[model samples]
Target: MRIINPNLENKLKKFGSDTAHICFNCGTCAAICPLFETSFPRKFMRYIQIGAEDKIMDEKLELFKCLHCGLCTSSCPKGADPGEVMLGLKRFVLDKLRRNQDV
Candidate 1:
């Protein structure tokens, strides 16, 4: 896969998880998402799974739109925890952005 930035891969790897492997991309995150009544995490998960790194970066503003309310995490049958994924991905992306800015 084309990784727009490999740093995120390394950061994500640090979590050392197969936690997301079981996601199956079901829409439970969407259905239960307090934000999904307007915002969406389901589509974001798909982007991450496919290594759609540019799209992820391009859509950065949308990620922060999450209210961090935890409904999506609690309701996921696959334990996909979209809320955690959102937080993790934000850290992964913005950490790099901050590093880049300092350089």
Candidate 2:
């Protein structure tokens, strides 16, 4: 069963993902990303767009793979700045992890 977090998109946006909503899954970001082997920017954006919080959380490693190189951002046709989105996701995940840390 696939779990969905409808608030995920709003959470991401509030976390500073300004261009998260602009992504249309064109795959341009993934194609231009050097870390495509690790699956990022595109995958993360898709998860955010669709509000798949569980999926996004499951792929925490993939989120960290982003180098913030800006290649994906520069090549994005929609000017979504996927690199920045990745950073935002990273921040969100980190905050979640911190809050859930075993004390």
Candidate 3:
């Protein structure tokens, strides 16, 4: 089952540079990331743009691997600010966790 949250892209836009939609999947962000082993920014950006909320939630650990080094943002050809997108993913995960917690 491919669960999709159509609102995810819009929600992410509110949190980050709002340029994620500009990403053409060029792989430049992933290529320049120090943590390329996990394909940080590009993979995560794809998840966001496609509204793959389940995949985004599944890769929470990968999301946290971001060092916020800004290299991804600097290397992005579309000014997508992928570093900020990673931070937004972190925030999204945290919020999801909090919402699922029982008080």
Models, CA RMSD each: 3.5, 1.9, 2.1
Question: What local lDDT does model 2 show for residue 7?
Answer: 76
Top lDDT model: 2
lDDT of 2 by residue, 1-103 (tens): 7788877867777678868778888888877788757445787888877778888778788678788899998999998889989898889889899999822
> Each prediction's TM-score against the native?
0.77, 0.89, 0.89
Each candidate's lDDT (Cα)? 0.71, 0.81, 0.81
- Poorest stretch of ten by lDDT in candidate 2: 35-44
Cα error, residue 25 of model 3, in Å, equals 0.7
Q: List the residue pairs that clash in candidate 3.
A: none
Writing each residue's lDDT as its tens digit, candidate 1 over 36-97 gives 55438887777766667778777888888888888888888888777878887777677777
Question: What's the residue-level lDDT of 60 in candidate 1?
Answer: 83
Q: Candidates 1 and 3: which is better by TM-score?
A: 3
For model 2, the stretches where C-alpha displacement exceeds 4 angstroms are none
Quote the lDDT for 7 in model 3.
84
State the lDDT of candidate 3 residue by residue for 1-103, as single tens digits.
9898888878876565466677889898888888766566898888878889889887787788899999988888888888888888888788778899721
TM-score of model 2 vs. true structure = 0.89
